[model samples]
Target: MADPKGFMTTPRQDWPRRPVGERVRDWDEVYVPGALLPIISAQADRCMDCGVPFCHEACPLGNLIPEWNDLVSRDDWRAAAERLHATNNFPEFTGRLCPAPCEAGCVLAINQPAVTIKNVEVAIADRAWELGLAPPRPPDRLSGRTVAVVGSGPAGLAAAQQLTRAGHTVAVYEKDDRPGGLMRYGIPEFKMERRHLERRLDQMRAEGTRFRLSTAVGRDVGAAELRSRYDAVVIAAGATAWRELDVPGRELEGIWQAMEYLPLANRVCEGDLEESPLSAEGKHVVIVGGGDTGADCLGTAVRQRAASVTQLDIYGQPGADRDHEVEPWPTYPKIYRLSAAHEEADALGTAPSADADARLFAASTLHFTGDADGRVRELSLVEVDAGRREVPDSTRTLPADLVLLALGFSGPDRGDGLVDQLGLAMEPRGTIARDDGFATNVPGVFAAGDAARGASLIVWAIAEGRSVAAAVDRYLTGSSRLPAPIGPYDRPMVV
Candidate 1:
C-alpha cells in the first residue's frame, strides 16, 4: 500500500547482469555489484499486495513477499530484511539461485509482468548485511537435548539453525572438507560466488551450531552409534547418484559424468586445486542433456577456452515465448530460457547457430568414436522419433574431444556405506521412505531434504529440514514449539 497505483506507474525492471565479455574472463558472479539498488525500490513498488497473495502459496517457505515489498518501496530496508528473514533462513542464497516460482504465481503476472520479487529479495538481504542486521541469533538457554544433523547443505543448515534457536544443542556433520554441499562444490562460482555461502556459514557457526567437517556419520562413526549418541538424528544427505547414458563406448577416456566435471571446476575456482582433471581446454566438448547442468558445463567450457561446444537434448525444442495454452499464468511456464551462462556464450560468438544456446533438441547419442590412444574423438548421434527412438537415416557424427554426461541424478547413492549400515528403507523411486512425521522405519532416526525427497530446489530442501526438525523436537519433548514450514508430502509449487 506504499503507492496504490504503483503497479501501473512503474514497470518491472530486472537486476542487471555484468557485461558478458568482462564477466567471462574470471569466476566472479554475473550480476554487477550495486546495480539493483538504484531500481529495486521502483520494482518493489510494483507489488500489488493482493487480497490473497498467490506468491505466498507458491513459495515453500511462505515468504512475506508483499510485506517486504511494501517495506522496500518505502526505503525501510532494515524492516524488509527482518520480514524476509522471518520465514526464510537464507534469502541471499535463494534470491541468487532460485528460479523464482513465486514471481510466476504473482497476481500481477495474470496480466502484466510480475513484480521483481527475486531482485527485491536480493537487495533486502544485501542491505541487511551492509547494515549489520544479519547477526547471529544464539539461543537464550540450551535445552540440554542433543541433535545430530547429517549434511551441510541448505536443508541441514536451516534445520540446525532452527533447532539451535529452539534451545537444543545441535551438531552438523559434513563429509566434505568444507561445508555447503552442492552450494560449495556442485554450483559454479560465476553463478553464485563462494563468499555468499561462507558468510552464511559464519553466521550459523556464531549461532552456537557446531560443525563437524570431514566427518561422515556412516563412515567415520557407525550410523547406529550416531543415533545412540544423540537424542535425535536428522539425515539430510543429498541425492547424488548420477543417471548415466548407458550406450556403446561409455568407458572412453574423455567421457565423464557432469558431477565429475562441475565439481573440479568449482574446486579450481576455490584455489584448493591446481587444475581440473576433466578440463575442456583446447577441446571440442559435447554435453548431453539440455538442463541447468548442461548450461553450467557449457559456460565452464567456454571459460576454459574450449575449441567448440555443443549441447543435445532428447526432448523437442521449447517455445521461445511463454505458452499460455499449455502453461498458463500463475504457474511456471515451459518456455525457452536464456540463463546468464547462455548470454555469455552467445556474446562470445561461440554459441550454436540454432537461435539458442548451442542446443540440439530431438537428438540422441548413439556412441562415441575414440582415437587410437583410447581418447574420445567424436560422437555418433541420430535424430529421435516421437517416441524417442533413434532414426536410422538421420545419423551424423560430431567432432568431440571431451564428452560430459550432464544427464541429471537418479537419487541418493545406495551403495554408500551409510545407507547400508543404517538399514534405511527406500521407496520404489530410490528415495528414503519416511513416515508422516519424516521418521524412517527406525524409531528415532529421521530423514529430510534430497535424501528423503528426490533432487529438488534449495527452498524445498530448507523447508523439509525445518519441518523434520519440528517433528524431531516434538518427539523428544512430547510437545514442542517449532515452525514446520512444510509437511512430508509437500511438493514445490513450480514443479
Candidate 2:
C-alpha cells in the first residue's frame, strides 16, 4: 500500500499550468517546468493499491500502476522507472498526451477523486532521465536472424527496440525524412518538445536499431524483395489517410485537411520553413470536428494570430462531470474536461462551455460558399437532433476565411502499394487484419498499431508493439522469453 491514510488525509490536486498570457506567446509546454516534482510523492501516496487494481486492466499497456505508485511514494524512482518500462515502451509520450483512462478505472473514483496517476508516471520517467537511469542495453549476442520493421512511429520503434535487445539484427524503414511519424509531425511541439523524442531515438540507435529514413518499402524496395531479405516483417505503419467531408465547396482553394495543415505548422517549428504555406495567420478559421485534432487546430491557429476560430461537433456536449447513470464507475466516460489545448482555447475567450459561438455542439455543416477565385469564404451549418435530422429554422452561416477539416483519419495509406503487393487482408474498418498472435495471413508477417487496429491512442500503439514483438520472437525461435502483454484483438472498452 502506498500510504495507510493518505487517501483520507489528502485531496486530489491537478498539475499546474503556466499563466495563459505567458504560455501562448511562446511554444513551450503549457505546464510550469519543475512544478509537479515538489508535490508528486504526496499525490502518488493517494493510490490505495487496491486488491483488484482496475487501473492496470484499464490501461491498454497493462502498466503496473500500483507498483510504480508505491515506489514513487517510497521515493525509489529507479525501481519506479523499471516498473513503468516493464510494460510501457514510452511513458513520457503518454504521460503528456494520454487521457488517463487509468484514473477513470481507479477504485478511489467510486467515492472520491482518482489518484493523480498520470502526474506520478511523468514524474518517474522524467527523474529517471535526469539521473541517467535509462541506458542503452545492447544485446551481447546476435540471433543471426534479420527483421525489417516498416514505419518508425511508436509501434515500430517499440518492436524494433525489443527485437534488437533480444539479439536480432532489426532495420526500421520510414518513408518520411525522419522517424516518429505522427509523433514527429502530426503532434505540435507546444504539447511536448522535440528534444524528448530526440533523446529517446538516440538511445534506440545506441542499442543497435538501424533506421533508413526517406526510403519507402513498396516504392523504393519491392515487397517481395523485402520479404525474401528478412526472416520476418512487422508493419507498424499508422493510419494516415485523412477523412473528407462530402459537402459542396469542399474542393475550394482555402479548404485543407487537418493533416495537411498541422504538419506544415510542425515543419515551421522544426526550422524546415520560415513560414507554413497554409499558415492560419490573419484569417477567420472554422474547424469541423470537436475531438483532439480540432482542439489542436484551435490552439495552433490562435498561436498564428488568427482573426477568429470556431470548432464544430455533431454530437451534443457532455456534462461537466461524469454521468454515472449512463456511464457507471470503472468505465471510461465521455464527460467534459478541459485539456491543455482546451485551456488555451478558453484563455482566448471562446464560449466557456460548449455552445454555438466557439465550441459549438449539435452542429453539422450543410454546405460551403466560395469566392470568385474558388477560395472558401463562408460555411453553412444547421443544428441537428440525435438522429441527425435538422432542427427547424436552425440553419445559419459563419464567415470562414479558411476552413480546416479535422475530421479524423480513415486508415493506413495504401497508395504505397504495400497492401496490394503483400496481398494483406484488411478489416471492415480499413485496417490490416491479423490473428490471435498479431500475425497476418502470410506466415512470419505481422501487423500492429493503427495499421492493425485503426487510429487509436499512443498507449495502445506501444502495447501492440510489445505484444507483437513477443509473438515474433516465439515464431522465430519456436518459443521466447519476452512478455506478450496483449492478444491481437485486445482493446479497452471505451470511445
What is the clash tally of candidate 1? 0
What TM-scores do the predictions have? 0.97, 0.97
* Tens-digit lDDT track of model 2 for 1-495: 668789889899878999888887877888999899889899999999788999988898889999999999899999999999888777898998888989999999988999999899889888989989889989999999999999998999999999999999999999999899988998888888888889889999999999989988899888778989999999998999889899988888898889999999999989999998988888888899988888888888878878778889998888877888888878889877777766766778643334733688889999999999988899999999988899999998888888899888878899998888999999888899999989998778999998998888888888888888998898898888887777878878654
TM-score of 1: 0.97
Clashes of each: 0, 0
Per-residue lDDT tens digits for candidate 1, residues 257-322, read 888899999999989888888888989888998888898898899889898888888887788666
Lowest-sum lDDT 10-residue window in model 2: 349-358
Cα lDDT, all candidates: 0.87, 0.87
**Model 2: residues with Cα > 4 Å off, grouped in runs:** 350-357
Assess candidate 2 and give its TM-score to the true structure: 0.97
